[model samples]
Target chain A: MIKTMKALIQREFWEHRGAFIKAPKIIGIVLLVTTLIAYITIRVTSAKVNGEAILQSGILELKDMSLENLILFWDGMFIGTSTLYFMVLFFVMYFFMLGSLYDDRKDGSILFWKSLPVSDAETVISKILTAILFVPIVYSLIYFVVLILLMIFYSIILLFHGLNPIELVWSPAQFIKGTLVMFSGTLIQAMWALPIYGWLMFCSAWFKKRPFIYSVIIPAIIAFSWYWFKVLTSLQFTNISVFKSPAVYLGHAMFPYSNDYMGFSGIQFNDDSEAQLSEILANLFASVQRMEILYGIIFAGILFSVSIWVRRYRNTT
Target chain B: MTQMITANNLSKSYGKFEALKNINLSIGKGKIVGLIGPNGAGKTTLLKAMLGLTKYTGDLEVMGVNPFKDRAKLMEDICFIADVAVLPKWISVDQVLDFVEQTHPKFSREKAEKFLKKTKLGKKQKVKEMSKGMIVQLHLSIVMAIEAKILVLDEPTLGLDIIYRKDFYDNLLNDYFDHERTIVITTHQVEEVEHILTDLLFIKDGEIVLDSDMEELTNQYFEVMVSNDNYDDAISFKPLSTRKIFGKHVMLFKNVNRGELEALGDVQRPGVADLFVALLREEEQS
Candidate 1:
């Protein structure tokens, strides 16, 4: 079973290299180039306005900032970068899961795959694994590489202005800790989004046409109908909408930084405060309820099993 | 002889349309069987049932296992090329080799590579880059490399040129077929596979119309050409079908003695294609 699963996963990688690997790498390159352009623009603008004095004052301010404020600034930066990266990752994963099984049947390649010794369950599970686990890991790795490049680029800019590269950029940035946080956060996000992935996969396997509409719009219609029903009948089935659970959990789980740094651009930190690394970790873990996690797993299991069953019996004619 | 497939009262329906109705068949090992039929004749549906690609009613078994319940285990010893174009177009030739090697316990990468060495297909070339003939060649190379007991082909050479079609059968007979393996093939061009098939099955409208060995089929069914005067006399023997050709009446009779039919103008074994058309004509008339 393990051997077959390994091959199946490898097959997914072969088919979706563009979505899983190339797209992330390209996103990384784009982010790096954007950072370089921004840095050069800042340098030119600073040079026009008494560059030496501005550089000295910036370094002096960095040195005077409290440790809590420094950590908050770096946390906000990490969160900001990841927000952009995850937005792209979300679309990549959504379209990929929606099309993974449908495309095989569309192109008549499912017959070839089914002719092998692998079972339908194995094939479907392998795709689910690829969508939920493999893609996030690949995206995280690219994000890590981009983060390192950005730090290096910033260090170069600091060195040009006679500032200590390690002290100004590397040490205060908390590179190692920030990367660990990103990896862990991605895994948590995958867990929170399992039901959404499962729904998309089921749509992919079951729908004959327009799987995107079936995966998204069907749920939207259901949620809207339930809301209308509740309004008219005055009966509350449940407060939570199944279609919006993942988004709700995701909004709550992301940005483990302190509440004071909630805004996207602005960073405000108290001068006398200390870095609350443990507290931030606690808050991140606490965001997801134990019961919600249990229900999500159950929902995912049911949808995935249905997806496998659909793949097994649905004829590709 | 071991029966590679057994279908007893196996039926399949799509909504109100019956795709296969009460199919009963036993295909033995080492025989190249040709399943011939017209469109919507349940040939592909039967193949799909045998390959466990669809659900069916009644008892059906392939290689002594319930194919629908144990498709993965059955596929370990069975291989099929449903069409020449079923391979994913995005995968490169080398990736195909690697994937099959990893998934199929019976697949031999070395043998597949050996077969590929004779072709112009490059290892790095994706299937989309190859011509239709090359793609068929590549698929054949992969299929032949697997050590399987039963091999099924459903129009495996469809959309290919005549040269490629002939080459496909030639390679199948020369490089793949042996006494240890059984082949079941379905094709529209009956004449092309007639020479290779040891057994013949004719299906019409979701039922088996004719099933016989090649030698037995020839012995049982004979066509006779009668002149204008002898046509009335020949019609007394009740030929299954008759058609006029060059001002002579050509009639196909099933299970009629050759000695009896020899009194006509000319008597000979009917070609498989002609036999198929005659059989379907008989079905429609009946």
Candidate 2:
């Protein structure tokens, strides 16, 4: 079973190399280039206004910052970069899961795949597992390359300014600790995002064509109908629950809210006060409410079972 | 001999149209059965049932396993090429081998590599980059590598030129077929597979009109070429169908006297394609 699943997942990676591998590399290049251009433009504009004094004062301010503040600045940089990566990861995974089960059927390759010894359940589960586990880990590895490159680039800029980057940036515990936080955060986010993945996969297997439009339109119609029904019957237009629920689930997906320092509570509550790292981690872990994750998982299980059953019969679009 | 496939009163319907109606067949080991049928003849539907691809009523078993219920286990001993050029176009040749090698326990990567070496296919060549014929070649290479006991092919060579189609059968005959294995094939070009098939099945309009071995089929159905002098007397024999070629009459008959037909002019065995047409025409007229 493990062997077959490994091969099946490997097949998924091979088929989706554009989204999983090339997209991240492209995102990294774009992020790097834009950041470099932005920094150079700011340096040129500020230098044109005041020459070397403005640049020298910035270094002096960095030199005067306490190690605690430097670490906090470093944490901010890590979280900011991580948020970009996670946001792109979510979008990439969204379309990836959306088309995963449907593409083969559309192109008529499902006939070839069905001729093999693998079962329908194995095929669909491999795709779900790819979305939940494989894609996140692979995205992180590529994301790490971008993160390290940015770190080195910043360290070089600090060294050019004659400041010790080791003390100010590289030596901080936030680098390793931030990664651990991202890992745990993503796993939690996977659970949080399960219903979306399951729904997309079920739509992929079930719909004959245009699965994306169907996946969106089905829920939209349901939510709209509920809204109209409530307004007509009870006239309670103030408290709307239908749209808020889906929007919250989709809202959680676009934001990496479970990562330390990314959450609002993880940041400092008081103005001009140093944020404690321990408190940030605690807030990050605490923000993940257990009951919602449990419900999302149960909802995901039901959706996925239907997807597998549909896949067994629906070989072509 | 052990039966590789058995279907008893098997029937499948799609809405009001019955795709297969009361198909009863027992294909045994070491036989290459050619399922010859015209369009909408339930040939594909029967193949689907045997492969566990479609739902049908009544009893159907392949290798003693219920196909739809235990398809994964049944697929271990069964292999099929559902159609030509159905492999995913985005997949590279090396990935195909790597994938099948991992998932299939009976697959021999070495055998696939050996077959691929003889062709111009490179390890990195994706299916999209290849011509239609090359894609079929790649598919055949994979099928040849697996040690499956029963192989089912539904129009495996539908759109190929003459050379590729001939090469397909040549490879299957010389390299793939063995006494321990059974093969079932359906194709439009019956003449090409006539000599290769051990048995013949003619399905038309959701019914198996004729089913027999090649030897029995030839012996039962005979074709006679009669000169102008013997044409009327040959017509009196109530032959299934007749046509004129080169100022001589050719008539096909089932279970006719061989010596008496020799006296008319010349006796010959009709090809599967001829038999298919004659049988369908005979059934339709009645």
- The lDDT values for all models are 0.81, 0.83
Residue pairs in steric clash, candidate 2? Answer: none
lDDT (Cα, tens digit) per residue for candidate 1, span B151-245: 99999989999999999999999999998999999999888999999999999889998889989988899989989998888999999888899
i-RMSD of model 1 (Å, 1 decimal): 1.0
Interface RMSD, one decimal, each candidate: 1.0, 1.3
TM-score of chain B of each: 0.95, 0.98
Q: State iRMS for model 2.
A: 1.3
**What's model 1's lDDT at A309?**
84
TM-score, chain A only, candidate 2, equals 0.88
- Residues A244-286 of candidate 2 have per-residue lDDT tens digits of 6565556556554543222323334445435544444554466
Compared with the true structure, what per-residue lDDT tens digits does model 2 show for residues B32-98?
Answer: 9999999999999999899888889999999999998888888888889888768998999999999
For candidate 2, the per-residue lDDT at B236 reads: 86
DockQ of each: 0.77, 0.70
Lowest summed lDDT across 10 adjacent residues in model 2 chain A is found at A258-267
Candidate 2 docks with a DockQ of: 0.70
